[model samples]
Target: MGGRFQSLREPVFRQWFFSSVLSASGTMTQGVAVSVLVYRLTDSGIAVGWMTTCTFVPLFLFGSYAGALVDRIGPRRVLLVTQTLLATLSGLLAVLTATGAEQMWMLYAIAAISGTVSAADASARQVYVIDLVGADRVSNAVALNEIVVNGSRILGPAIGGAALGLWGVWACCALNAASFLPPLIVVLRHKTKTVTHPHTQKIGGLRYVWRNPTIRVCVLLAAASGMLFSLNVPLTPFTTAIFHLDGTGFGLMMATFGIGSLPGVLLAAAGPSRPSGLRVAVLAVATGVAILATAYAPTVTLAFVGVAVTGCASIWFISLANTLVQLESDPGMRGRVMAVWGMALPGFSVVTGPFIGWVGGVTDARLGFGVAGIAMILAAATGWRGLARPTARTPVTSGASRA
Candidate 1:
C-alpha cells in the first residue's frame, strides 16, 4: 500500500492533496446545490444546461492562453491568484443566494466569473502536481487526484443535498465558500522553485499538441467524451422526472456516480504509469456501454447501479487520458498541453452543455442521455485506429522531433 502511494512521500504534495480534498468536497457540495437551485428557480433542463454552458464558455475561449501563461510564470503563482479569486467568487455567490438576490442571470454571471478564473486555475493545478511529485510518480499522483475528485462526489453531494433540503441553497453555498480556505492557506504557505519557460508562448502549446500524435488523439478523445460527460447538466431532470425524486434524491444520485469511481481509481493507481492506447480505447467503450445501461434502466435502483458503472468506467478512462497527456508532453510544455487537455475536458462542454439541454428539453432526458452514450461509442470507434498503434517510449524533449 505504501508502495502504491509513493507520491505521498513528498511533503508538499501530501499537504496540497489533503487540503485540495477538503476544498473539492466543498466544491462538489456547492455544485449539487447549484444544480438543484437552478432547477427550482427555472424548472427547465435547458436553464440548467445554460448555467453549465456559461461556466465552460470561458474555459473554451481562453484555456490555451491560460496554459501558456502558466508555463511562462509557473503554476504556483497562477494558482495563488486564481484560488484567491475563486474563494471570493464563492463568497459572493453565498451572499447573493443568502440575500435572495440570485436570479438566473445572477447565477449565470457568477458561474462565468468563476469559469474565467478556473481557465487559469485548472491548468495550474494539473501541472503543479508534476512540480510537487516530479515526473516518476506522475501516474500515481494523477490517480490520487482523481480520487480526491470522485471521492468528494461521495461526500459533497450528500451534504449539499441534505443542506439544501434542511436549510437552503445559501447554506450549501456557504459551505463551499468556506472550503476554499484550506487550499488557499496551503498554496500561500508552500514554496517551490518553479522554472519559467520564456519560450512557451501561447500558440506554441497548440503547435506542440497538434504535432504530437498521442496528444492529438488524447485531445480529440477528451473533446468527444465531453458531450457524454455533460450529462451532469441534465441530472436535475433525471432526478425529478425520470427517478421521481427531490433535492435529496438528486444528491444521492450524484453521489452514486462519485461512489462508483472508487474501484476505477484504485485500478488506475495500481496500474502502469505509462499509458496505453489500447487501454484507453477499452475504457471508452466500457464508459459508453455503462451510460447506455443507465439511460435504459427501468427502475431508479437500477439506474443508480448503471450510473455507478458509468462513473467507474469514465473515471478510469479520464485518469488514463490525463496521465497519457501529462507524461507524453515535455515538462516545459506541460502546462500548455494540459491547458488544451482542460479545454477538451470541461471547456468543450460549452457546446455540449447547451446541446444536451436542448435534447432533454425537446425529447426525454433518457433519450438525450442515450444520445451521449451513442456519441461516446462512435468517438471511441473513430479514434480506435490511431489509439491502437503502440506509442514507443522515447525522451521527447523539443519540437525537433514530431514523433
Candidate 2:
C-alpha cells in the first residue's frame, strides 16, 4: 500500500496532483453546464454534439504542433501561459452568459479555443510531471494522474447539475473559471533548477513513435481503446432491446462501468509502475472478453458484472500505456510524443460513437460489442511478441539528458 503512493511524497507532485483534481473536477462541471446550456439555447441535440466536437477537434488537428511547442518553450512556461489563457477564456464565457450576449456561434468559438488550449495543456502537464518526479516515480505519477481524471469525471457532472439547478449555468461557468486558480498559482510559484542540454535539432513526434517499437505499441493500444471501449453507443440497445429496461436501467449500466474503473486504476497503481508489455496485452485481451460477456449476458444482473470487469480492464490498459510512453521517450522530445499519444483518445471520440451506434443499428447491439472485442483481440495479438520481450529503460535524474 505504501509503495503504491510513494510518488506523493515528492512535494511538487503532491501539490500538482491535488490542484489537478480540483481543476479537472471544475472542468467537468463546466462541461456539463455547457452541454446543457447549448442544448437549451439551440433546442437541438445535434447542436450539442457539435459543441462537444468543437472541444476535441483541435487536438486531432494540431496536437503535434502544440506538443512540439511545449518542448521548445519548456513545459512550465507553456503551462503558465496556457493556464492563464484558459482561465481568461472561462471568464469570457461567464461574461457572455451573464450579459445575455451568448450565441451559438460564440459558444462554438469558445469551445474551439478551449480545445486548442487543452491540446497544449495536455502535453505540457504530462511532460512536466517528469520534470517534477524524474524517472523512478513516473509510472506511479501517471497512474495517479488517471485516477484524478477518472474520479473527477465521475463527480463533475453531478456537481455541475446541482449547480445548474440551484445557481444556473453562469454560476457553473464562474465556478469553473475560479477552479483554474489553484493550479495556476501552483505553477506560477513552482521553482526548479536543472541542467540544460544544447539541442542541435528537433525530431518529429511521429518519427520517434515509428522508430520506437514500444511506443508504437503503446500508441496503437491507445488508439484502439478509443474505438473498442466506445461502449456507450450500444447501451441504449442493450438496455431497451435486450434487457427490456428503462432509462434508469441504462444509467445503472453506465454507472457500474464508471464504478468499476476505480478499482482497475487502483490495482494498476498497486502493482509495478514500470512499463510491462505483458500487462498491457493481458488487460487489453481481458477488456475485450468482458465486452463480449456484457454483450451476451443472459440477464441484466450478469451484464452489470461484465460492465464492471470491462471498466477495470480499460483503465489498466490506458494507465500502463501512458506510463510506457512517458518512460520510453527521450526527455527532449517527450512533449511531442505525448502530444501525438494524446490524440488517440479524441481521435476515436469523434469516429467511434456513431460508428459503433451504426453497427448496433445494422446488426444487433451484441454484435457491435463482439466486433469491438474482436478488434481488441486482434490488436493485442499484434503486440504479443513485442510485449513478451523484456526491454530495459534508462532512468533520468533530471527532466532532460545532457547533450
Candidate 3:
C-alpha cells in the first residue's frame, strides 16, 4: 500500500495535488451554487437542464480538438491558459451576481465557456500526470488523483451548500475564482521540462480512437457512466422536491456519495496497478444496479445509502478505466485518446441532462434514474466481451517509445 502514496513523494506532484484539492473544493462549491441559482431564478427544471447542457455540450464538440491542441502545444501551457480563462469567467459571474444583473442567458454563456476550457484541462491533465509521476506509478497516481477529487467531492458540496445558505450565490463563484489562482501560479512556477507528443491534426485523433478497440471500448463505457452521473444537474432539485430537504440536507446527501467514493478510490490505489478488464466490467455493472436501486429508494435514508454504493462503484469503474487507458495507449496518441474520451464521455450530457430533467419534470425524478440505470446496465452487458477480453501486456510508454 506504500506504493499508493508514491506520487506524493514527488515535490511537483505534491504541489499540483494540493492545489487540486483547493480547486476541487471551490469547483464543487460553485457547482452547487450554480444549480441552486438557476433553479431559483427560473423555477423550471428544464432551465436547470439547459444549464447542465451548456456546461458540457462544448466538451462534446471541442474535446477532441482540445486534446489534439494540447498535444500540439503542451499540457503545461494549455493548463496555465485555461485556468486563467476560467478564473476570468468565474470573476465575471461574481460581478454579475454582485450587480444583480445576472441573467439566464449570461449564465448559459459562462457555463459554455467554462465547460469548453475545462475540457482542455481534463484531457491534458491525464497526459501531464504521466510526465510528472512516471509510468510505473501511473495507476497509483491516477487512484491517488481520485482520492483528492473524491475528498473534495466529500467536503466541497457541504461547504458549497453552507456558502450558498449563508452568503448567497456570488460567494461560491468568488471562491471558485480565487481557487484558480494557485494552480495558475503553480503552473507558472513549475520547472520541469515537459515531453511533448505533437499530433499534426485533429482528424487523426478521431481516426486513431476509432481504430483502437480497447481505447474505443473504454470511451463508450465512460460515456455510459458519464450519462448516468450527469443527473447531477437535477439531483439538487429532486432532493428538495421529493425528500423535502433543505440546503444542509442536500449538502449531506452529496457528501454521503463521497463517503462511498473515498474507500473505493483508496482500494483502487492500494490494489494492483493494473486491474483486470473483467474487474472494470463488474464494477460498471454494480454501478448500474446501484443507480437503479437509488432511483426507487423508498426514503431519503435509503437513497443516501444507494447513492453511496453507486458512488463507490462509479469511482472504481471510472478510475480503473482511466488506468487501463493510460497504461495501454502509446504515449504519442494518449492525449488524443483521452480527448476522444473527453468528447464522447460528456456527449451523453447534451441529450441525457435535459432528457432526465424533463423526465423529472413530467413524471418523477426516479424515472430519470430508471432510464440512466437501465442504459448503463445494457451498455455494460453489450460491451462485456470487449471489456473482458485479454490484451497484450504493453509497456507504459513515456512518449519516446514503449519497451
Candidate 4:
C-alpha cells in the first residue's frame, strides 16, 4: 500500500470511507438547513446559541463514559445502536417540519435526542477508524476522515441551500434521514469482530488524560480553542446581516470554508506521519487571526476569504491535535482518550456556542468573531509551553503507552 493514501488500500476501510462520505453529506446538509431554519423562525442569535447548546450538552455530559463504553464493548456495537437512533431522530425531525412544527422547543428536543446518540457515535466512529485501518495507518486514516468531514461541509451546504430554496427545510431533513441508510448498510455489511476489554483497570478517561502530558495539553488547548471554532453560531448572523445574502450565499460562505480545508488536509497527509505541537500552536494563532479578519471584513468577498483562511488553519490545528492524541494513546484506552478529545472540542461547544451566539445577538457578529479570535490567541500563547513539552518516560507513561 502507498504511504499517503494507504488507508484507502484496505478494502473494508475504503468501503467504510465512501459510505461515511455519503452519510456525512446528509448530516452536513441538515446542519446548515437547521441553522437557517432557526434563524428564519426566531431571527435571534441567542436562539441559535441555545440550539448549539442543546446539541452539545450530551457530549459534554457523557462523552467520557461513551468512550469507556466503546472500549468495553467495541465500536461496532455502539455504532449500530447509535446510527439507528440517529436515523429515527432525523426522520422524526423531518416529519415534524413537514407538519409545520417549527417551534423552538421542538427543534431543541430533537437536537438533544440526536446529540445524545452522537455522544457515543462520535467516539465509536473515531475508534472505528483504528479498527478499519489498524494503528499503523491511523494518521493517514484520520486525515482522510477530515477530508470527508470538510468535504461534506462543502457539498452539504450547497445542496442544502438549493434544497431550501426549492423544497424547503423539510427536504433537507428528509434527505438527512435517508442519508443514514448508506452508512448503516455499510456497517451491517462490514464484518469486524468485537473485542471487549474486560480486565482493564478502572481509571476514568478524564483522569487518564490528566496524567498524560501530551494528551492533556492537546485536550486543554482544544477546549480553549473551541470558542473560536464555533463559527456556525456567528456565521448565521454574519451571513444575513453583514453580507445580506440568502440561503445560497450562506451555503457558499460555508462551502468556501470547507474548500479551504481540503488543501490543508492534503498537505498534512503528504507530510511526516507524526504530529507537531509547534504546528498546532501556529495554526491556532493563524485561525484566530483569520477569524478576526473575517469579523472586520467590510465586503462579502473579503469575509469569504477570511473564513476560508480560518477554515484551513482551524482544520489543520484540529487534525494535528487528533493525530497526536491518537498516536500517543494505548490501544486499549484509545476510545476513552478520544472521548476526552470529543469533550474538549465538541463538548466544550455547549458553553462557547451559546456565548458566541449571545454576543452576536447583543452586539454584532463581528464583535463575536473578535471575542473568539482574542480567546484563541490567548489560549495558544498560554498553552504553547505545555503543548511543546516532550513526553516524559515515567513508569505510568511507559505503562500506559504500551498498554
**RMSD in Å for all candidates:** 4.6, 2.5, 3.6, 4.4
* TM-score for each candidate, following the candidate numbering: 0.85, 0.94, 0.86, 0.84
Local distance difference test, per candidate? 0.82, 0.80, 0.79, 0.80
- Residue-level lDDT of model 1, residues 1-403, one tens digit each, is 7766778888778888998998999988998889988999999978886777788889888888889889899888999899888888888888988898889888999999998889999999988887777666778888899878766867787799899998888888888888888888877777666666877574577789888877788788788778666656668777788879998888788778778888777777777878798898888888888888888899998998998988889888888888888888877788889999988887887777668778888999887777677777888887787778877564433211111
Model 3's C-alpha root-mean-square deviation from the true structure amounts to: 3.6
In the range 98-127, model 4's lDDT, one tens digit per residue, is 899668888999999888789899999988
Clashes of 1: 0
Error of 3 at 191 (Å): 3.5
Error of 4 at 270 (Å): 1.6
Q: Relative to the unseen true structure, what is the Cα RMSD of model 4?
A: 4.4
TM-score: model 1 vs. ground truth: 0.85
Q: In model 2, what lDDT does residue 374 have?
A: 72
Q: Candidate 2, which segments miss by more than 4 Å at Cα?
A: 194-201, 228-231, 397-403
**lDDT, residue 273, candidate 3:** 67
Sorting all predicted structures by lDDT, with the top scorer first, yields 1, 2, 4, 3
**lDDT (Cα, 0-100) at 78 in candidate 2:** 86
Q: For candidate 3, what is the lDDT?
A: 0.79
CA lDDT, candidate 3, residue 93? 95
